[model samples]
Target: MKIKLYCRRALMTLLFICALYTTISSISNITLADMKVWAERVQQETNHPSENSLKKSNLEQKTMNEQTYRPKTLEEAIDFDQYETATVLATGYTAGIESTGKTSEHPQYGITFSGVKVKRDLYSTIAADPDIFPIGTILFIPNYGYGVVADIGSAIKGNSIDLYYDTVDDVYSQWGKQELDVYIVEYGDGTLTEEALKALNEAEALQVFRQQYIEQ
Candidate 1:
């Protein structure tokens, strides 16, 4: 009787150990399967796309970049004569030398003109003729470097453009009066119309004497 009882107890202990091991193994397998499913779902979401959204975004960016820097039409690409004004290129010289009689020690060595100023009136021209040239234009001059259309000018009234020189010497040295082609860079205000430009030309550009100087 004693031996039979001892044998029964040993049998029950072995069964309990097997049950625990089976439960642990089943739990581990379940956890691994769940992890794999989650990883697959994440990858699928990342790979999927709605439509041509990416392509459309890329195209829009390209257009904007080209419009910002490149001139599309022939009118956008124009050439004009440049007039030189000053001999030296320096900032704030006028203010510095206004009080002091001394002019040479101010840093820049160049002749200053009293009455004339020149500029390229890009906005006005674009406003006058959008068909010819659009706003937000960029221009490139080979020898003159690059300039943006910041504002309009009275002399730069038509398809004409005005170039600025640092000095009279530079203007003469570089042949300021000669014609040069200008590439339309970006866009700005507008282009000048033919009619407006003609009117500007007909008007008196300069006045030498006021009026009625009859030997008084």
Candidate 2:
């Protein structure tokens, strides 16, 4: 009887140990499976970004472009648009007899063909062909700044323009002559004053000028 009881106790202890081992193995397997699934999810996210991340990248690029862009030229900086362009042979002149053939003693010595006194300081006086750029037209030259078409010359025809200077020295030293591309910023009313008509009145030119410009 004593031997049977001792054998039964040993059998129960063995069964308990087996049950504990089986439970530990199942827990380890479940933990390993969960870890594998988590690692795969991390790798997928690294390979392919979400739509929200792509949108954020695009926004950053657009902002960078805006910050880098800048205005290049004077016209662009001032937001001024050119009405037309011309390639001109530019010449400099002064109010003296050497340039305008009119002495200071003359009645219309410093007066322009458009009947206004020359504004030599601003370089706002230019002689152009009335047929091309009429009186009051405004132009922008690269090296010489701004000039207004306020005069005409017998020699200034076609794409030739004459810029005004305060002195003959300025004419030679500042700007002798140049071939340049000029911007026409604004056009004139195409109307000439009575004094302008008188100044431009060469017999043949007057007849044509009257028919084309004055009559209309």
Candidate 3:
């Protein structure tokens, strides 16, 4: 009988020890889970961009890259319109710099004239009345290179223009008086040409011309 009681007591003690160990293990598991959750929350609190923010930033950068800011050539200028103030669809003929070597000596704007300025003798120089074409205007001649309306001449009236030449040979040899298609690219105040037309409409000498050519 004594042996049986001893064996039974020992078995009960073992069972109690196992139960206590299980309880402790459960608590440790819960603590570990809580620690993991806290760590994840701290990570989120630190400075880090979310997936949505990263995507939006990338999209904005892409938009900027795709935008064409400034046009370098006439073909490129046609693709952009934000800088355009007025669009003139007209045709006329081209001449050379006036005689007496005036343009070569005293250039109006020093490599430029009126408000138009560019490098000396790099691109084809076109001169037009400031009242009509204004300074700082871009002209796209189909067969010719992109030219700036950087000068004016006394003979350059109505739709006439004088293209400058580096040498007298070029003046007489190539570009003397040739018909050209003029596309005037204007910017800034945007009202110069329109205002000039308004003034011409009120002129008495232009009455007949306005009815035939200017109005159209």
C-alpha RMSD between model 2 and the true structure? 17.5
Worst 10 residues of 3 by lDDT: 207-216
User: What TM-score against the true fold does each predicted structure earn?
Assistant: 0.27, 0.53, 0.37
Better of 1 and 3 by TM-score: 3
Residue by residue across 1-216, what tens digits does model 1's lDDT show?
999999999999999987876787687755556768979877875697335766777889999998798543323443323322212111111112331232555443222121112222221121112233333344544444433332333333445544444334544565345454555545445543344433432335211111211110
Tell me the whole-model lDDT of each prediction, alpha carbons only. 0.40, 0.74, 0.51
Tell me model 1's lDDT, rounded to 2 decimals: 0.40
Error of 2 at 119 (Å): 1.0
Residue-level lDDT of model 2, residues 13-82, one tens digit each, is 9999878767876877655467689798778767987788789989999999988975444444443343
For model 3, the local distance difference test gives 0.51
Candidate 2, residue 164: how far the Cα is off, in Å: 0.5
Is candidate 1 or 3 superior in lDDT? 3
The TM-score obtained by model 1 is: 0.27
Scored against the true structure, residue 83 in model 1 reaches a CA lDDT of 27
| Predicted model with the maximum TM-score | 2
